[model samples]
Target chain A: MANLKNNRYLKLFTSTFKLSACTFGGGFVIIPLMRKKFVQELEWIEEQEMLDLTAIAQSSPGAIAVNASILVGYHVAGVLGALVTVVGTVLPPLIIISIISLFYKAFRDNPIVSMAMAGMLCGVAAVIFDVVIDMAKVVFKKKRLLPLLVLIGAFIAVRFYAVNILIIILVCGVIGAIDTVVHEKKGAEVK
Target chain B: MIYLELFWSFFQIGLFSIGGGYAAMPLIQNQVVDVHPWLTMTQFADIMTIAEMTPGPIAINGATFVGIQVAGFPGAVIATLGCIFPSCVIVMTLAYIYYRYRGLNMVQGILAGLRPAVIAMIASAGISLLIMALYGQRSLPSDLKQFDAIALFISITAFIILRKFKPHPLWVMAGSGLAGIILYTLI
Candidate 1:
């Protein structure tokens, strides 16, 4: 039993490490890969369970990759498994970024490099704008007043008012919680 | 002390990153760029580009890059840990609660509310980055002469390509880099 448990932990670590190392474009890209590894391949988690875990991961704070890894790891083995997976998931980027950082001065000073980076900066802005548009579309699809208000309000607060983002996030979370409780109460009343 | 600050800053980043990597951008900008002056807007844009190109989560990549730039290798380790620490605790607790009580209506509700806020945050970050990329400054320039028409053209073209063709991001990055070399360097 001990050997089998150790083997499981090791497998969990290796799987996450490999997945994290290979994944690019971040965010939702990792989800399908993870579902493939843990569900289709390992069969450690059921299909519906993985979906639920994904929902939890998406809704909660932090990187979805790390959050999903933690939940899957905990579901498989417990706290130790969670720890193992988190470390595995983090190590790849930590290693990659560290190496890139070493070249910081070289990259910063080279005019050619700077020009390329400047161009890439434009691309980055486009990508971010795409994200905003995509997400806004999702929110607007729901056709709710509060969500729409929150969207516009949050934008104005950060862009114009220069409100601290920390405060904005906290207030949004609180608003979300209250909105939820009220809806639940109303739901119960109607039922 | 720098290490402590790095760790704490990233800790807050991870905690409030609520939606995902993009949503975390405004929070990160507030901390590293505005609050601490650890990174300039230009450097922040560069890091975002690198983070997008690299493997793994953008938050983790950004934290590691900033940490190393700020301090060193040890800083990188510390910052990365700080960034993921919240995910560890939060995910575990939520996982346990989820299993214990399967109904997640509240979580659903919160997510619905958060969706719009996260979008707004991304838009805010996008605008800042756009200003930096097009005008070559952190904010809007005092004069129109500072604007780079080439950069704006590249950005608009990139946006249109992304919306229509939906090519891999790597391709887009490469295309933009090539355009930069041709327009700014070779010319």
Candidate 2:
């Protein structure tokens, strides 16, 4: 950590801001760009650590973009790092969206714009479909039966029953905890 | 009143919307379109499309859009801040706990259990969005009572482009926009 130069705070803020400004699509789209910036360009973080952080960010609540920023920030400079990175990450969207909001009515009423939006929704949906496939491949790989059941159960609960998402997460978390404790006991008995 | 509601609603969304940006869509739909009377179904779709094209996360873009529509600039700030507030605190706390206890079996198990469910939620969200975009009444034709052939073509074209070249999504979206302008005008 000591190899880093002073003014690391400014560096962190600007670097994340740059990434946030440049990246187009949210979520998985930013991972490679982030690896390029933080791991390759600056050497601020190790490659393996970058992967680990990405995993943690995905699993944690909130936007992947925000979570990733916080992880990188916390890693590089601690709490201050996290704060600056969050600001950096959120600033671009705030600006762009605010500007759009000013012209919201004009954008909405224009037939040409509406047509373009219709086409864009199609494209966006397709892109999200790709994301679902990518995530499924990663999540299902080498997964055991219990985890698989949780996956299906969760989908059914949310998609059909319209169950609250937080409840599902909480229930699954508890089940996972129990699974771990039981496995530990088995291991101890065997030993 | 609207400002406070915007902040409070988005804060709830921020707290519970897990997985990623897309996972927040359904919850946002429920809050903005269903519970409150902020955006209509068509408007929600448009906001999502705009959010996709914009920089930063969709969730933030959504909050900003809804906030602005409701109460202007300050509303935008409040909603955006509220949306991100929970994330900052939660992630910071998790980052601390994660580093300390990452190797523990219990923590690992929790994540493992959670990962599959998260993936499922993402899938469910994606499918529902796709359905709404492609076949939902608002997206399709009204009198003709049929799918919009142009939109269908654009979706397939975009999917193929992404599949073959694996280009950045921005390119896919940009190409789709260009096609939309051209195709929709022509037909």
Candidate 3:
């Protein structure tokens, strides 16, 4: 039993490490890739479970990748598994960023480098725009009115008022709970 | 001392940075640029580019870059830890409860509401990034002349490439950088 637990922990660490090192972009991109690894390749998790975990990961207050890693890891090997997975997942970025920081002065001073960065910033914006559109597609596909309203309202609050994000999330969560309760009550009445 | 500061700020960022990595960009900007002045806007933009290009999530990359830039490897590790700390704790708890109450409507409702707001946050970040790329520090009319046609062209071309071709983002980043060098510096 102990050996099996150890193997699971090791597997969780290595899988997440490999995924983190190989994948770029962000959590959104990594999600599908992880589904392939955890569900298809390893058969560690079912597709439905992965989807549910992903939804929970997104709703949580952190990077979806980290949250997903922890969920999968914990599911596999408990608290220790969560710790190992988080470390493995974050290690690559820490190492890579540390290397880049070593050349911080040169990267900032080089005219060519500055130009490249300037150009890449624009690229980053474009990529982000794409992400927005993609995610918006998912949200709008349901044709639900509340989510659309919250989307616009959240944008205005953040862009114009600079409202604290925590407050916004909490408020939206309350509204969602109320909306759910009301709807369920109506459904029961109809029955 | 600096390490402590890095950890705390990033911890707050992690706590409040709901939705996903892109949504955290603005919060990072506020902390690194507006609050601490550790990185200027241009530097922040460069880091964002690097964060996008590198592995792992943008939030992790951001924390690592800012941490290293401010301190060193230890700072990078601390910052990354700080960033993931919330997720580790929160996710473990959720994992325990979630399997038990997977069918709970309250949980479903909360997530449903959170999703759209997160999308909005990402949209807000994208707009800010667009402004930063296009106008630089010059938002006013007189400073608007600083706007570079070359940058605008690069943005549009990159978007088109991404939308049409759907190549990996690494390719898009490399292509844009090459274009920048050829257009801005060589010419």
- Window of ten residues with lowest summed lDDT in model 3 chain A: A23-32
Which stretches of candidate 1 lie above 4 Å from their native place?
A1-89, A96-104, A177-191, B1-87, B94-102
* Per-residue error (Å), model 2, residue A28: 8.8
* TM-score for chain B of each model, two decimals: 0.56, 0.60, 0.57
User: Which 10 consecutive residues of model 3 chain B have the lowest summed lDDT?
Assistant: B137-146
Q: List-wise, what DockQ does each model earn?
A: 0.43, 0.46, 0.47
Off by over 4 Å in 3: A1-81, A100-103, B1-83, B138-146
- Per-residue C-alpha lDDT of model 2 across residues B1-187, encoded as one tens digit per residue: 8888998999999988887776899999999999999999988998887776567888899998998889888888899889988888988888898788868888878767777776676566556545555665433245545666887888888888877887766567667777888998999
> DockQ ranking from best to worst?
3, 2, 1
Better of 1 and 3 by DockQ: 3
Model 2 chain B worst lDDT window (10 residues): B136-145
Q: Is candidate 1 or candidate 3 better by lDDT?
A: 1
Worst 10 residues of 1 chain B by lDDT: B107-116
What CA RMSD would you report for each candidate? Answer: 7.1, 5.7, 5.9
Candidate 1 lDDT over B34-58, as tens digits, reads 9998999998988887776567888
DockQ, candidate 1, vs. native dimer: 0.43
